[model samples]
Target: MNWNSPIPLQAQTLNSLPSIMESHEPLLSLKQYSPEIEVYPAYYREGLSGAIDDCLLRHGVAQRLKKAAELLPAGIRLVLLDGYRPIAVQQALYDRQRNHLLEQGWTESEEMYAELHRFVARPTVDPAKPPRHFTGGAVDLTLTGPNGWLNMGTPFDDFSERAATRYYEQKSDLQPDEQLIRDHRRLLYHVMNQVGFTNYSDEWWHFDFGNQAWAILTGNERACYGGVVPQASN
Candidate 1:
C-alpha cells in the first residue's frame, strides 16, 4: 500500500518522550550579538517578496553565506529557496501537509500525529508550535553553478526520511529509469555538508540557526531573526 495515502485510525502517540529534548546547540542569537560582519548585496534582490526579513537577517545571514561561498569551488554559488518564513506561512505549510495526508484517507486520530512527525522534527498536536522558520532563524537553500541548479539528490522539501540518507545510498531507492536524479541527490548533500550548516534529518534543504533545535545542535541559548520589522525609509 502507498503509505502516504490516508487511512482512518487513531493517531500515533508519543508517551515517554520528554517535553524538552536536546539536540545540537545554535551558532548565534540576534538578541545577544549585533551581527559583526557585513551583510551581502545579493540577498536584497527581492526574492523574498512576501516573507519576513526582520533585523535585516537576510543581510546578516549573507555574511556567513559569503564565507561558505568562499569555501566552495570557483563555480558554485548558493541559491536560497526560502528564508525568514512568517508564522502564517509556517502554519500554512503544516496545514497543507496535514490536509494532503487526510485526503489520502488518513484519520485525524492516527494519521495526524504520524503525518506531522514524518516531516517536522518535533510534531506537536498544538498548531502554535512550528519549526524554527516561524522564528526567522531557519532557511531552505541549495547550490547552483554555471551549469544551472546542482543536483541535490532530492527535490526541494521532499518529505521523506530517505531524503536524509547518504546520497549514494538514497540512489538505490529510485526506479531503474532515474539514475541521474539519484546522482544529483548525493551531490547536493555532499556540498551542503561541506559548509558549516547541517540538514534536517528529514529534509535535504531545510537548515536553521536560532531555533531550539538549532540551539541544541549549535549550543546556543537564544534564536536569531525573532521576527520581521520593516526597514525605515532613508
Candidate 2:
C-alpha cells in the first residue's frame, strides 16, 4: 500500500494560528488509563532534568489515544514514550540535541537551528507558542507486538532523515526489513490519524491533537489546547 506524507509544521504557521477559546482540559495519566498502553517515559528513563516518570496528556487526547490503541491490529500495543514535558525537560532535550548537532559538525548559525528545530522545539515560556509537549497534547509513541517493539525504520528521538514518517514508503525496491518497517509505520500513522491525531512528518512516533501543530495541519481555525504544566494529581 502507498502512503502520503504529512506536511511538517513551521514556527511561522504555529505563530499565526490563534486559539479562539483556550481549553482548560486537565492532564490525565496514561499509566492509569489502560494496560494496553505501555507508558515508558523516555526522558525520565534517560534521567533528563524535570522529567516525570509517568506519561500524561490532555483529557481529550487520552481518550483519543485509548481509541487508537483499540484500533491497532490484534497483538500490537501502543508504547507511549513521552508526553506533557516541563520546560526544564524541554530545555534539556533542546540543549542536548543542539550539542549533538554541533558535535556532528553542525555550525552555530541559522542552518544548524533549522535542522535542530526539526527534531526538537526551542524551549519557550510563551503560552501562545509553547513547545509541542508543553501543551500536554502531543505524544511520542511507537508500536510493540507479541515479540517486542516493531521496527519503525528509526528509533524514537532519531534525528536523521530516515526518521521521517514516510521515509520507507518513499523508497523503491525495499528489502524485507525495510518493507516491514514501512508497514509498521503505516499502521501506527493510520491508527492514530483515524483517531484524530496528526502525525509529525519529521518523526514517525510523534503525533499531536488539539495543539497548535494539530490545528495547523488539520485546518482548524483555532487551537483548543495551549501550554500547560501537568499537576501531580494528573
Candidate 3:
C-alpha cells in the first residue's frame, strides 16, 4: 500500500466505481475541516480558498482530517502543505522536471516515462487517469508542535529515498536523531490509519483518503474519488 503512486491503481487488478463518488463531492476548504489543523498551501497564492488562496478537497476528506487532528497529542497540530492541485499546475511541474531530466541525457521512451511517473504523473488525460493530487484526495502534510515542525528528516516533496515513510526503519543506524525521525513518522502514520487513510509508503508526507489507494489498503470493494472532482465541505 506504499509506493510513489497509489496501491489499487498500482495493482493491475481494478475495481468498479462506487456510486457515491462517481463525481467529485463538494470541495471543502482545509480551514473548514478544523481550525485546529493549520493549512499551508505550497502552490497556491491565488488558487482556491480565495482569501488565503489555499486548496480544497472532497468534503468526505475534510471529515476524516478533522478526526485525525483530534487524535494528536496536546500542542501538536496537523499542517497540510498541499492539496487540490490543478491539472495545469501538475502539467507545468511535470514538464519542467522532465525537460530537465532530458537535458541531462535521459531518453524519451516508456522506460523513462515510467521512472518519471513514479514521482510525477504525466499531465495528459487518458483512461488510465492522473495523479492523486489532481483528484483532491491526496495531500502533503506534516506535524507541528509547540516548538516547531517535527524533524521529518527531509522537507516535503523531497522525492528521494530518504523521504520514504519507512526509510529510517530500513537502516541499522543507532543515531538518536535517526530514531527520532522514525518515531515522528510512525506517529503520523498511526493517527492517519486510525482515520481510514492509506499512506504512500514511499513518501512520508503523502497520504490518500477515499481514493483508489484508500480502497486497496482498507479493502473497500470500490474507490470513491477518481480524479479532480471535489464538492463544498458541508
Candidate 4:
C-alpha cells in the first residue's frame, strides 16, 4: 500500500525514501527458495487472471524470509499469502475497496479516497514509482505453528483498528481471550522485526523488507527493491 500511511516510520526509514527510489534491483521469485516457506499466489486473484504470473519477490526479500523461517520457534512455518503484485492488480484492489466504501455511503470525496487508501495503496501509474506490493519487497502473510494458525485476532485483510499491530499491545478495555491474540501478535512482531523487516501498523499480516517503506523505516540509504513486473523489473 502507501509506503508511509498509517505506519509511522523510524527516522532512518524516513530519510531513505529518496535514495531507495533511485535503486534498480532485479526481481526474484520465491518459488524455488525453500519448500518450508509455503506460498499462496494471488490469494485475491478475483479480477486479475492473465494479468499475474506468480508470487515473486526481490532476492533480498526471499533471503530475509529464509532467515526468518529458520529463526521461527519450533513447530512453525512462515505462510506467504501474496507477493509481487502488478500495478494492475494493485489498482483493482484499491478500486474494489474504494467502491465498497462508496457503496456503503461513506461520504464520497477525494479526501475519502485518500482515507480509503490508508488500508490499501492507491495505484500510482508512474512505472518509476510503484506501490509497496509492486516493488516485490512487500508481502502479506501470517504465521502457523504447531498449535495451528497463529490467530492475530482479526483475519488478514480486516480493515479495522483491531488489525493494528499495536491494537492488542495496549491493555485497554480488553477481553480475557484477547490477551492470547495480543500475545500471538507480539510474537510475530518480535520475530519479524528481529529479521529486519518492518510491519505496516495497519495490517498485522503485512511486512516489508527492503522496499521504499522498508528503506524509510529501517533507515537504509537506499531501498533494495523497485517495481516488479511479472517478469523483469524488481
Highest lDDT scorer? 2
Query: Looking at model 3, which ten-residue stretch has the lowest summed lDDT?
Result: 1-10
TM-scores of the models, in the given order? 0.60, 0.91, 0.82, 0.83
lDDT, candidates in the order shown: 0.50, 0.85, 0.74, 0.73
**Mind giving the per-residue lDDT tens digits that candidate 1 earns over 19-105?**
223222333333233332222223234443343332223444544545555655567666666655544555556676787778878
Instruction: lDDT for model 3, please.
Output: 0.74
lDDT of 3 by residue, 1-234 (tens): 231222222233336533224445877888766788899886564342322367587788888888989887899889988777776788776886788779879999988788677777777544245567777788889999989999999988776789878787777964999888878887888788778888887789988987766676667766777676334699
Clashes of 4: 5
> Residue by residue across 1-234, what tens digits does model 2's lDDT show?
122343223333454765635789898889997767998998889988888889989999999999999887689999999989888889999999999998999889999999989889999988768889999999999989999988888778988899987788778899999888888888888788888999888788999999988998878988898888645784
For model 3, the superposed segments whose C-alpha errors exceed 4 Å read 1-24, 45-52, 103-105, 126-128, 229-234
lDDT of 2: 0.85
Rank all candidate structures by their TM-score, best first, as comma-separated numbers: 2, 4, 3, 1
Q: Indicate the residue-level lDDT of 123 in model 2.
A: 94
- Model 2, residue 31: distance off in Å is 0.5
